[model samples]
Target: MPAAVVDAALIVAAVLDAMLMAEADRPYAVVSTTVAALALAVRRRLPYLVFALTLPATAVSSAVVAGAVALYTVAANTRNRRTLAVCAVIYSVSCAATVGNHDLPAPTRVDLLVSVGYNIATAAAAMFLGQLVQARRDLQQRLAEIHQVREHEQQLVAQTVLAQERAQLAREMHDVVSHQVSLITIQAGALQVNTNDPDARTTAQTIRDLSVRTLDELRHMVTVLRASGTAPTELTPQPTLAGLSQMIANSGIETRLDGDLPTDVSAAAQRAIYRTVQEALTNIRKHAPGATATIRVRHDGDTIEVVITNTPATRPTVPLPGAQHGLIGLRERAELLGGTLTAGPTSGDGYRVQLRFPATTQ
Candidate 1:
């Protein structure tokens, strides 16, 4: 829109210059101004060629409007400082030539001075306005680049936060759901041994096998959550209270068991109990290799309590490094089942873990 307006103004100026030259009886003034104005229309697209054409018309006529427009276009479009300088010098020379050849009966010193001053002022103003426009365009481009960089950085931060949240959810799901699946596996094994009918035994064995496979898949999911590539060569189902005796027998450390375990407790409560015991025994094995441990389970009507304690290590080996979220996972499990778990050093030179759950509730 601005370019069209500029072109229209240049044509109007050319017509005015032609009328003035006709009154002064200058030769071929209309033809020279018409050619200069036509060249102005293509100044932005072919700045150097338009500028060169304007010099010849400027030398033949006294009007400088078309030449001034061509100079501004050259300065605004050209990025090279040396090229702009050369165009400015050439345009200044054309303006001087137009002033020297002005039609007058007998030009005086004051007339010449006035013509020279007007030509210099007009050329300087056109160059200054063109440079101002170029500076504004450069500033706008830099601001756009800065905005894009900030937008990209914000996207990266959002993606990182999303990944961390997913990993945390994966850990919570593994801790809570894996316990219930272990209970199902244990019950199926027991049913297979106790049933006498051939069909009943076969169903029980199938259930047990499926449960084991589910546990393997769960372990693989947990490994993915932790961002580790290594998988267990022989996946094993998690242990429960039914297998507590066998676990103790396998451990080389001396251990004792006490309290009456309830078979009628809710599955949620049973899971919380099993996790607390498992985490406690693991801590003992990792931190105190030769420690003597004791396990206790008690039913007091509405609530069930389980406690596992281990003496200070008699031959403490180098403590194995672990994920260190065992106790944290156990506490989360207990709380989800409306229970509480506590673990710390006891007053008797040992570590103790205790869990209490409402026996009748999920």
Candidate 2:
């Protein structure tokens, strides 16, 4: 819009200067003015061409307005230093021609000096304004590019911080959980050998088995967290529904297992299911010891569901220190596998943890 306005103004100035101010004959004035005015319309698109056309017209009939406008447009639009040099040469030649016009009366040295100084000043001002506009536009473009680069760098910093935090968390879990589970396994092994009753021996063995498996998984998780590349060859395979029975038996809570579970779920879905059940059992042991729990796994078309519920604790016991991040971690795991988890108090006097996942067929 501003370019259109500039073109209109330049055309009008050219026409008025030729009609009112030109001392040339009517034919030469008309021709020069028309050519100069028409050239201004294409100044933005073809600034060089417009400047070339107006230079000759200005020289022939003193159409200074059109030539000045053309030079300004070329300088403002063209980044090439050579184009500016050419404009300075053309302007100098036109000013020399104006000063040396033989038809005009001979001037005194003082008057000639004043005219030359004024012409130089006017040409310098036009060029300076054009250069100023161009410089401002260039600075704005550079600032915009810098802002985009800053935003990208900030995103990279955020991701780096998050990765570092995750690695630190994995190390802490290994140090804490691995030590506790190892103690349990050692005690359970001792109990199994010392116990006289067959049922007591069996329960102790189950505890030992579960503790060993949990330790394996804990070690694998620590390795994964610490590793920046592919997993180590010694890393244990992830647990699935096949190991669900061992988890329930070792839970030490009287848990009733039901439902026909599928064996061919995706590895990610399997990990989510296993972790959900493990967290539920751990919570039961921590908050509701000696509670009667039910473990239900169901397979419907395109979906698999697992629900673990425990009745109220019979004996009140001292609560142990807990970070209370188990359910939060489980929710993250479930969502990663395109699954959902809901854990809360049951309708009755109990707690329930439910998990659902999209199933993969064999």
Candidate 3:
């Protein structure tokens, strides 16, 4: 219906009810009806408070029409189930009491019966309407909660994807750079002792040639990673137990390899050991570039252990941002493999990193 039509209908109802029913002529009845109508204006804003304020006046005046409307408003608008239920019971009881108290003659019987029927119909209809309102509100709330949970799950998936991408990039860089740097380290050590011989010039040229090739490979790898639809290269082969001795020798660190290595250690356990060695060497290069270092790998039956210790360099090393992140990452990896990693300054005036892993195939 149009707004004008609705307003006109309501005005007509109020006027006709006031005029036709002599009971509305009473001051209490007129006042109660006006108050109830005004109370309904705020039903959506303060439903329970409005109902409480209007109900007693309605009951005292026996304004069944106004009281029933207020009860319906309370039932439909408030989320408080207990309050609505209590209002419903009160309205029902007051209606029954008001009807019983009326002493009517034969002429009034029809009016009384009509009033009772209207009350019963309005009560039933209002309760059903209130239930519909409550159901709609509950459904909206549930949908909002579900949407939030799905959004949170999506954010978590995005973060995981980003982290995996970073790790893959790091692996690619390591493969290319480690090989070239290894050549530099080998040639530099060779030059420290070999002062004579024309063959030294040939060896230096060989190192430079290998480094150029490695740089070309690195450029190709980076280009492949950036271009759309290019399939990523196979993951870099993770270092294993066999690479430990080579790593120590290449690092120019004095390392003692003793005791038997568990041949049946889990892949996770082996990876942890490799990462521990890699991080220790990187830290040494950055902090104690020319310091003497020692690394030990041993298996004591049920456990595999690796320990790396380096002497302090003569000059103080500047700390770098996220230097601790390496140790933290190494520790987390160790714990995941049912092992432990500890890295910090040692009492012997240098840094030390230790990793211990369970030597079990499972």
Candidate 4:
């Protein structure tokens, strides 16, 4: 049930019970009783205060339910046992004092004993019910924590397996792939020297150059994969504003860099800008092929913003495999740097990604 519904029900029931028990003579009793009963609306937030308001009503016949419910709420929410005991005792005394408000003569010994015993028992019952509710709430919180811990453990296990596999793959690439690529480079260099034909010599030289670049890229990957033992590690020498021009040229899409942004921003801010552009360009390639992209980096006051917008794809998009967490990681990183990232489809049937962050940080 919704909490609002439960609260409404409690207030209604308490008011109706108060009306039934109220004497017809005292209009003030009716008003006071109703006010105390209505106070139940905020019992969850101010349990002790609400109970105190209900205490005066407890010594009259009109507000029986209000006092009991208020006492119960205090017991359910309060963690201090001594405080709860004190509240319970006060409630019992007020309830027993209700007899003094009755029309009958001063009560005999047996009646007084019964009144005290019965009121004490009622307060005890409310305490027990409240304690039961408190225990259930604590149990539910513990169960939620257990579920979260279980999920974290599973992620750790999956990461360990992935790290082991990458380590093994790195070894193979270093020993087998690197060795073959080196041999190809050597053979291409030899052919370039020994060939007499101009075309063959030129082709060998091209092959040698490509092989050497491949070896360098391969070594970079191997080093990264081998070092990633416990977490998903990004490649070293991460891209920044200094490489923005070169990256745009190499992205394979028709693109324009539209701003001359500052280069003195902290390295973290630069990487955020670089990654935002890189990811935007990558998505354009995958999901919006043949699209034209415009990257605009702006510095206004102490804030830097990068806006990458792409026109609609000129060709049909081919489905590609991706982890799909690039934007999530970027969003998380931006928040860590006191920044924000937003991406969505444009009004012109295009896509746009915007990244904003503070320009300077210690």
lDDT of each: 0.70, 0.72, 0.61, 0.79
Model 4 global lDDT (CA atoms, 0 to 1): 0.79
Using lDDT as the measure, the top candidate is 4
- Worst-scoring 10-residue span by lDDT in model 1: 228-237
What is the TM-score of each predicted model, taking all chains together?
0.57, 0.55, 0.53, 0.57
Give per-residue lDDT, candidate 2, residue 52.
83
User: What CA root-mean-square deviation does each model show from the true structure?
Assistant: 11.7, 14.6, 9.0, 18.1
Segments in model 2 whose C-alpha atoms lie over 4 Å from true places: 5-20, 78-83, 99-104, 227-362
Give the alpha carbon lDDT tens digit for every residue of 154-211 in model 3: 9987766655565446444543354435446444444634547568766765665565
Q: What tens digits encode model 1's per-residue C-alpha lDDT throughout 1-362?
A: 68789788887886676566533556565676677778877877898888887777666676677777788887787788788777777777776676556445766789778867777787788777778788888889999999999899899767666665555555554554554565565557667878999998999889878876776677667666656311111112444567666656754557788987778866556556765766676567556756899988888888888889999977534323344456766776677767898889988779999888788775
Candidate 2, residues 215-298, lDDT tens digits: the string is 767767766665542211112356677887887677666888888777777766776777777778777765775578888988
Give candidate 4's TM-score.
0.57
**lDDT score at residue 112, model 3, on the 0-100 scale:** 71
Relative to the true structure, candidate 1 has a C-alpha RMSD (angstroms) of 11.7
* Higher-scoring candidate on lDDT, 1 or 4: 4
Candidate 2: clashing pairs of residues: none
